[model samples]
Target: MTLEPDLRDDLLAAVPSLRAFAISLSGHVDRADDLVQDTLLRALSNLHRFERGTNLNAWLFTILRNLFHSQYRKRRREVEDPDGSYASRLTVQPEQGARLDFEDFRTALSTLPHDQREALLLIGASGFSYEEAAVICGCAVGTIKSRVNRARSRLSSILKVDATEAIGSDPVIRAALHTAR
Candidate 1:
């Protein structure tokens, strides 16, 4: 069903705040603009889920936050090596050792069971607390902790590196491994 005129107006009025929040979360104007657009589209599509007389702003913000987190999780696994420069940098065996190590870590991460991987990503890469991860994953806090621990151990074994040894210079990779403990 189409939104009523007043509801449509309210949604349009929320755009500025949504864009600002997106910018603060993304730290890039272009990405923030895209995020705001996506948020509005999602809100429009899900208007039936919105309750009348409730805080429309809160609902929109929640949608934006969820979209950001979902995108963040997907983006963390991607390498932005548009040209050959990044791969060439890794060719220097000594100076760019971390680059190679990051590749290996990424491969090992993909081999993890979905549950363990999800827990690790939420807690480590996304910087969510155990309680928050538990809520997101619909599991007990202890279960999330267990999954993270198991995932870390499995990754360490697969990469044949000491659990405490620093693997890659990539901040997200380092955060995932370091915070898994």
Candidate 2:
């Protein structure tokens, strides 16, 4: 029992709407699109179970939401950013408009221990609430906070990137560092 041709067309058309909703809920566009695709497939396969008289849009949204929840549960322990775009913000325009700090920060981040680094990335960089970070990392809120603090300390100490040095790839951090210096 698959969705009819008309229903399939409708599902394809609703991808954008489904994606937007998924992004809002999950805060990651790549995950949102993947969720939408999965929802469409599930809707098509389970079309027979759908009550024809009900709203199809609502049904699809529900399917996508359910899938998102399932993924959250399955990956609670995994540091999975489906979109992989979440990081420190602020536009970077170097002397030649090069994006250098990303590679630098990536190298800096790679050197930290897993726990400390994950905590800082989730809280300081990705803007995840301590509770959300804890849920994502399978830890207590206090533990998450402690990890974040420790991670920042360790990175600052290791990189010697001088939190006070006007040396970020972005204006915001550079300005702050300049002011601090």
Give the TM-score comparing model 1 with the true structure, all chains together: 0.47
Pairs clashing in candidate 1? none
Candidate 2 residue 131 Cα shift, in angstroms, is: 44
- Alpha-carbon lDDT, every model: 0.88, 0.73
Model 2 over residues 92-118: C-alpha lDDT tens digits?
Answer: 455543256545556777887899788
RMSD per model, one decimal: 17.4, 17.0
Poorest lDDT segment (10 consecutive residues) of candidate 2: 172-181
Candidate 2: count the clashes. Answer: 0
Clashing residue pairs in candidate 2 (N, C-alpha, C atoms within 3 angstroms) = none
Measured against the true structure, the TM-scores of the candidates, in listed sequence, are 0.47, 0.41
Best by lDDT: 1
Q: How much lDDT does candidate 2 score?
A: 0.73
